[model samples]
Target: MSLGDDNGYGNDSGRTDDAYSTIGGTRQTRTRLPDGEGGDGYNTPRRPARASRSLITMAGVVVLLIAAIAFANMGGGDGNGNDGDGSGKGGSKPEAASTAATGTKPVTGKNGTIPSGFAHDEQGAQSAASNYAVALGSAGMFSTDTRRSIVQTTHDPAVVESLVAALTKAYSPSFLKNVGLNEDGTTPSGLTFVSRTIPVGTKVTEKTGDTATVEVWCTGLVGMAGPGSTKPVSATWFTISEKLKWVGDDWRIESSSQKEGPTPVNGDNRASTADEIAGAVEGYGGFTYAR
Candidate 1:
């Protein structure tokens, strides 16, 4: 299913400088005129005059160099040093908040490969949402029994029954056929049914002692993989917003909704063949996502 398509179904270089002049090895002798002859020429000695001029030139060069360095450090050279919002005067702008892992250990508990026993705090809520997204978007959701297990495990107990019923109808025979699966939700022989969600990140938008609203940004591969398969494996990006409650000493999903992506531009990489896609999906396992 598309993230939004959960009709009762589960959703979601530098330079250098130089100075000075040189002369032949032998110093030129200077003829001194009497103290006040002509030319301010009391033999004031030309070497010191030349040396003073050289020193001034070198000082000017140094000043210019310092100014250039300061400008660069202030991000005047490239705009990257400036915070996009214009709040920073860069000496290395603070890193923008990111979805990168916070180094918190992921939930180690599992209910049949689906993560469980999430902590009751905000991080736990986010972790719950992300893992729930994966479970809800998995290929198992196409089958009745597995789907029931997933719903029962991840959803609030109060709502599990109704959700199971709705999802059963949502994955009706027609829907299964449309997605290249059989009446019983199994792939045709030699074909691999692919329905996997990879969570890009999770954010807790609102939270309280017992409730949280989280948004999981995700990308998914759905459809079938095989020779001549009409519904080739394809990727979609979307966000799943779930309301979670602290229930049974762990976080469970209360409800969820989805929408189209905060998608990024596609890369220019070559698309893989169906066999290759199938192999990759089968070979690589998923992760326990955490915020």
Candidate 2:
């Protein structure tokens, strides 16, 4: 759920000067005794050996210095960068994409109850994670039919069956009863079972052409809403991490996990009555998320 060598100086006059090479901040001084002296050179010096032995040492040091600087530059990168030409990694990458709205329209289609037609890009991955979190956290996950639909619609085909089985086992009769639902996962005659996720924000923590890891920070409603309901609807805060594969032109979750949140302190507002909560839920429609 959450979370690894030379520097040289050369003097003129064809004299092999005693060479000092700094590699990785460690300086090495070598005494070159003409061609008879033994030393490791990174490259063959243009000048003849006896005269250019120190130059060779310098060349080796220069090569190492460049390599060290290059390695240093490549070290601290976020590993999500690309050269504009797409030929290398960790070039002068553009500024990180902001989490604020990008003005792009949200997806306009649905894969059954789930949103479809997400873009084949990072934004699309974020959207998929957000919407999938909502579907997975919703009341549909408690019902067998809708649960299967939610799992199949959002999960990668390779794992859909397994997820379905696991979720079915997890939402057993006792679990349902504990949550005030009927053994069959139905709402009681006078009660409305509320379970819905609202994504506060979505982030693409990792991304590639065909795979992505997105984290969706969410707040959800979970409980029963009706008069005399002991399980009154309450708000929950958490984050959902979704590993998505670009499967068949759309993002499907390969795996998913949840963790308790960066939740805020409880507010002082009075709790709404069960009837009011149910009415508000029915009156409010969910949304299709986007970057």
Candidate 3:
């Protein structure tokens, strides 16, 4: 997903300057004459007054303008609400705490199946893609059985077998140990392995019926949390672009690619003690994403 302005336009200042230059010069300003509107200082010709509009006529024009505006909005008025929050109508909805506090609804199929339940809207697609990225990057992908399950659950069934095989080769034993896990992908005794992906947001690069290319940019905690641990869990950021198909009643990835971080700097807060980190890791649980 692209992480840039969805509006794809310049700001008001640029618009204003362009409009002014079009009309006259860029520095042009509006100024009323001293005798403007024929006050006591009136020197300009006393312009002929026109007949006043009938109240009914004025009211009719106002009603017509309002109706026209409503019609345009119904068709698609750029998705921006009058509230100025940048979130469109689909994004400004309420959400469940268990699924994350994002103000968006779960993607649902028309018949309550996979990608089908997804909102046939951009925000819904973005939300779905983001969660899918997290589940794809999880530590579960390192184990053969769990890796197959993860891929099958999150990917289009038609491509699952091949993708699973590719992933199995990608997450080698050495790669697991390099990230602070044993060759078998388990943490050593007294340490809790931490490999969880949390998505910050998503962007849709392209879309069409039954297909979309989306990028889910995520920050993850990966490592071991235990006493005397030299390698504590830390964050990594990456973007996972997924090619999706509307399958099993929802969007499923056909394939995905990951890239390194554009991550922000870490804060100076004191790090949690190793024991505290281990306890927290054991006590807390992760999420089962929908939208």
Candidate 4:
């Protein structure tokens, strides 16, 4: 591209900057001083003292930017295992950042269809809470026998009966109808019901000898998916707080409660059709989550 001498900073000008500077990862064109107010004669222009000074100033700014980037690039760990900028690498270290992955393996046992045999530790409590959240929000929870089985398997024996009764009432026939299910909680012949919870993260709020209070942040899909479905599958976010007790060599929920989310702004993606949503749920399997 040629911007003739009408602009004094043109290539014909002696003080042109041919290179671009990258700042904050984006390239920017170098700024040039405007044309000198007046010149010597027909075509011989005199560059003022300020023009030279401005060139020097531009060079100084470039140097400072380079130095700043070099400082940031030396992202080395300090003696105390933190980056010089006070952020850790957040990797496989004993004292990793609070939000870093712990690199623990998934639990290998199952209590019926739900995960079981969690370690008798804080991580175990968190894992149990997360899996229990999945169970409590699942399609199985909408059915009577399966709901009883899941409740009995995951909840503390002392509270199982009462919780079952309470949950049964909560999923009354009217409630089932409201969610687009049959009075008995079955989907219509051509429809598929989706009620699955996915744990986003877990945290231990209180831990002691044999009890732990864990809060699992979760997102879930719910409703009916099929042709002519009035209630299409939709997403929800909530936190399930589980009071866990270490029993039978594993963690079990003594009680659990839920609250509305730290919801995020919706994205611009188009919503899938009922059949598409139903097909994806059938095709994909959930993870055996680990902390």
Local accuracy by lDDT, each model? 0.48, 0.49, 0.40, 0.48
Off by over 4 Å in 3: 1-104, 107-117, 288-291
Off by over 4 Å in 1: 1-95
- How does model 1 fare in lDDT? 0.48
Each prediction's TM-score versus the true structure: 0.67, 0.67, 0.57, 0.66
Model 2 RMSD to the real structure? 26.5
**In model 2, what lDDT does residue 263 have?**
70
Best candidate per lDDT, number? 2
Task: Give candidate 4 regions above 4 Å deviation.
Answer: 1-96
Query: What TM-score, to 2 decimals, does candidate 4 have?
Result: 0.66
Which TM-score value belongs to model 1? 0.67
Ranking by TM-score: 1, 2, 4, 3
Clash pairs, model 2 backbone: 6-61, 7-21, 7-22
The C-alpha RMSD in Å for every predicted model, in order, reads 30.4, 26.5, 24.4, 26.4
> How are the candidates ranked when ordered by lDDT, highest leading?
2, 1, 4, 3
lDDT of 1 by residue, 179-272 (tens): 4579887889987766666667666656667987766666655545666555555555555556677887888866544444566877766667
Q: Per-residue lDDT tens digits of candidate 4, residues 1-291?
A: 012223211121121121111000000001111222332111221221121111110000100000000000111101121211112223333343655667889899987898988888777777776666666556666578976787677767865565455445544677566555789978889888766666677767666778877656665555456776655555545455556788878887654333345568766676677788889988998677777
How does model 2 score by TM-score?
A: 0.67
Clash count for candidate 1 is 0
C-alpha lDDT (0 to 100) for residue 194 of candidate 1 = 61
